[model samples]
Target: MARKAAIIGGGVIGGGWAARFLLNGWDVAVFDPDPEAPRKVGEVIANARQALPALSDVPMPAEGKLSFVSTITEAVEGSEYIQESVSERLDLKHRVFAQIQQVAPGVLIGSSTSGFKPSELQEKAPEPGMIFVAHPFNPVYLLPLAEVVPSPKNPPEAIERAKEILREIGMFPLHVRKEIDAHIADRFLEAVWREALWLVKDGIATTEEIDEAIRMGFGLRWGQMGLFETYRVAGGEAGMKHFMAQFGPCLTWPWTKLMDVPEFNDELVDLIAGQSDAQSGHHSIRELERIRDSNLIGFLRALKERNWGAGKVLREHDERKAAAFFGATDSAPKAAPLEMAHMQVLPGWIDYNGHMTESRYYFANSETIDAFLRLIGAGMDYVAAGHSYYSAETHIRHLGEAKLGDRLTGTIQIISADEKRFRSFVRIMKGEDCVATIEQLCLHVDMAAGKSSPASAEVWAKLKAVADAHANLPLPEGAGRAVGQRK
Candidate 1:
């Protein structure tokens, strides 16, 4: 059964929580007093649908059902997890918790308060142990960090369970050791925010200038290596110890107004707001959000390729999905086109004409063929061991259009095989319809010598079995046809 998550507020953070859980295959029930909550949350989910799948190497799980409920009571019904993202008012949060505990005191409840400590949130509560902090950054569906703060009143097991749930939804839960005013990340950000305000207030820099200083410089470094590591690299060959010794003394300098506060008057607000409007007012919030999402996807995918930092979290998620796929799979030969891969048409896959591009069609086929190769033991490890199958030629036929968000299935039918070479056919399907077909010839090679080579005995046995099963089936219509051939 699909697990359920209750989202107490449907603003940006709450909606992001909904999307994260829903996309990870958890049914979500959302409750927000705003009458426009449905439209608001729907927009966030639409952004998430395009952004999240692009990060995964494996197919995303079947999306869970999303429902907007009338009350907190309706939202928390049968919920295994609940995230409260209501307004930042203390009394408002206390009342929200009281209502939640009144009905379902046992269900784990988390708060998305960026500034409030867990102790503050847990006070005046009948079930304080169930209420803790789970502060996430904006665009929670894309970014992975969740600052989980638990007071001493909370049980260890419950806190661990909270972390596990966060990880399951592809979040990296940084457990805050003690209850601090604004958990780790926010504190650092608050310092930067204050400094940025001072810079604008003092006419030292414009909004766009500050943004450029970050994005063109440290922001790129920060995205991958983060603050300490980036500075550590700044230390040169001696590492962090050398860095701290050299730059640590600069901490006492009056380089920043870390201790000073700018007066918060109309003048200050207007300076910042007007500058920001001039900096980014041309694009609507949604348009800027799309731009941000696209940039983040590119950055995160780069990290995933290197298997470093936030990318590592994404890879682990894919690994978890792969484990489940293999454990439940029975790959014995059968008289059918073997379903090898499941894919989605992501944001970058569309061409100028708005159809899935031709390259992606070949990519879809390659994914199908690669999965089949892995199943038959001629995969990456086999290549690393100096023997593998390499595609010599391919022919693809596009029969129908596949638009964005369309789910695709790639299935393979083996036509024939020998010791050193094999021919196969693949069909990319959308539901019951086949959108395209690909036929390919592959040759096993001795990598060191760069010549055709016989397959390993074990791989040959498996491949021959599947090939033998497919031999009795009628040949796929386009199997041997050359380009521009008649019907």
Candidate 2:
């Protein structure tokens, strides 16, 4: 059954919520007085459609219907979830919450208020237990974290339900143990923002320089391994305790003005704006967002492949989505020489000759193997259950040159399979011509025992089926061919 979600305000955050829910297969109805709400939300959804799928190979759920309604009641009526993103005013929230509760008495209400606490939001509501702060980061469709903070009056079941629904839409719901003015992530951001203001005010760093200081350094670290874990690694063999003891006194030093705020005078505003313009005037905001999304997709995908931090979350979500996709199908589709990979040659793939580099061919083959693994049910759950296919060896033969923007595809032929081992051939092509060929041998490993093992009966059956389907196909000449010519 298709689920429904309601958004009370259709600004950036609300539109983001709409895009997230809509893309994840939830019908979203948004209520915003702004006449331009539909256009604005549509723009955000367009960007989301371009970015979110680049993060994983698992096909996203079919997009759901999006409607812009006139009244909050029309938006929230019969909806499974309701998110309020109105102005950050306590009085306004009280009015909104009262209205939402009256219309959909028991439905969960998530307030996207960065400044207000759940207690403040629910103080005047008829059913306070259902109202909580489900604050999400900007570009909500792309970023996964949603801070779920409940008041003392909130029912535990409501909190869990909020978490469950957030996870359903590919969000990492962090439970805030206690409600505070600003949640955990915002608290950290506020500190840095305060310090940046001080830096700009004191002429110590331009806005662009301050941004570079972050994006080129700690920002990258924080993205993969957050502050504590990154510092733990920096602590070396002695670990966190020793490192903390060594640097504990620095906390008292006047190294930062986190408590102070620079006046929002025109001089400061002009200075910041001028620096920003000078730094990034070349690209429009939409173009910049696309660039940012692309960069994030690349980094997130790499991290996911390694199963680290946010990457682990992404991998887990993709696995669940894949499982759900297969389950919803009427019957499992037959696999025969599956076209497992399709991608344009990224700019980074070019070499000095302005052609695709040598290593990318192998990388494409590796991706093909990953796709094949997913097709045969060797997804995250299979690995989680302590079984996986690990590449033992690979041989590659290049036939033609590929350049930037070339549309590349890799077709995987199941050469042979057994209970313990499998061999496959991947033909890399640009359009119809074969550009490269890869012969790979993989072994099913008992991850817990750290040795080769027979594949699970179910997995073996899928592989055997594919191999049987390809039985009549001739093996590529590159298969079993040695790299060196001997006398």
Candidate 3:
């Protein structure tokens, strides 16, 4: 049976958790008090469906169903894991934890508490070991780091299980050794924030300037490697010991007030807000979020190619998600007799006829073939890597008229192929009637030099095997002879 996860809370964090689990093909049940919780959660998941795929190289898995429950018990019944992301108040957490413990005894319960320690959370539950703290950052679906802190009463094995689940969702979980007030990341943030406050008080720099300094400078390197690791590399041939000996004396200098706390007076708050407004001038929150998400996707994908620490986490998660949906290596591929998808006829593809032009039929049929190519590992990256096939020639026979607003479906089949080239037939159907037939001859092309080339031995073998397996299938009626030849 497929694994199930229940989330209590339908705000930003809870919605993000639901997106992550659902994208990985886990059935998710959500419990939230908001009357419009279902609509809001559905919006977040819809956005994730479009965004998460562009972040990684691999294709996304089939999305799972999202069900909303009015009561917590309905959400947690038969669920393997319960994630509590309700309000951060200690009392509220305790109330929710107590309710969860009563209904779901054996299931793992994780609280999304940023500051509260596990010991504090355990006080509300009947069995302390069943509850642990799994704190995640904002935009949890994209940011992969999660801090897992367990109490003394919690079983040791719970940490490992939490880690496994987090990894399954593409998160790097760090176990906090000892329970602290703010845990690991918040401690560093508090220090930096303190200094920022002092600078604002003294009018040294505005809030936006400080943010710019971090983002435009060292923050880029910090994404793939930590500060300590970067500094070690800067030490060069002499290594860390030699580098530290030279710079250690500066530690005593009166440079920073690491212990000082800034007062949050009205004047200070107003000054900071005014300066921030001056810095940004004018930009809507939605616009800023879109820019931030795009930048994050680019930076993370760059790191992913190298298989760095965080990159490896993303890669493993993608593989696990694919395996979960596509089945294991031993399992036979599920036969899909035919696949159908709805496509919006773009304005650019329309002709003076104000309808889908003749050429678009060939284009849409080709795109359907490209989808099959992706299933066989000949995807965008494969073409970009200078190892892909291009259509040498095509024959199209248009039988019926298709307008701009009309919906169309395409069906495709492989006819034959040798070492260097392959033949395919595609039929464009509308309302159970064949509208067009296209035959294509494609040859392996060397993308680098823009020249025809023989397919690699490995590629040839895979293509041959796929072609042989699909050969016996009859081509759909109306599929014509090679594009140049008449039927």
Q: Who is ahead in TM-score, 2 or 3?
A: 3
The global Cα lDDT (0 to 1) of model 2 is 0.86
Better model by TM-score: candidate 1 vs candidate 3: 1
**Per-model C-alpha lDDT, please?**
0.92, 0.86, 0.76
lDDT of 2 by residue, 1-487 (tens): 7899999999989989999999888999999999999999899888887677667555567679999999988999989999999988899889988888888999999999997888888786899999999999987988889999999999998899999999888889999999999889999999998899889889999999999998999999999989999889888899998889888999999999877788989998898889899999999988998898888888888898999877887888888887864443222324456777665565566788988898888888887788778888897899999999999999888889898556677788878888999999998988899999999899999999999999888888888888888788887676898888442
**lDDT digits (tens) for residues 1-487 of candidate 3:** 5689999999888998999888766889999999989987887776566556656544355457789998999999889888999998989988887888788887898888888888988885788898888888867778888899987887888779888988887888899889887789988988888988898888898788899988998887788778788777778888787779878898999778779877888988899889988877587654565566667777777778887867777787767655543342221122222342334354345688877787778778766677656655677878878788888888788878776435566655667888878887776777687677778888888889788787777677766776776677776555555446655
TM-score, candidate number 3: 0.75
Which residue pairs in candidate 2 collide?
Answer: none
Ranking by TM-score: 1, 3, 2
Global CA lDDT of candidate 3, please?
Answer: 0.76
Clashes of each: 0, 0, 1
Clash count, candidate 2: 0
User: Model 1 scores what on Cα lDDT?
Assistant: 0.92
lDDT tens per residue, model 1, 291-315: 9999999999999999999999999
Per-residue error (Å), model 1, residue 467? 2.1
Kindly indicate the candidate among 1 and 2 with the higher lDDT: 1
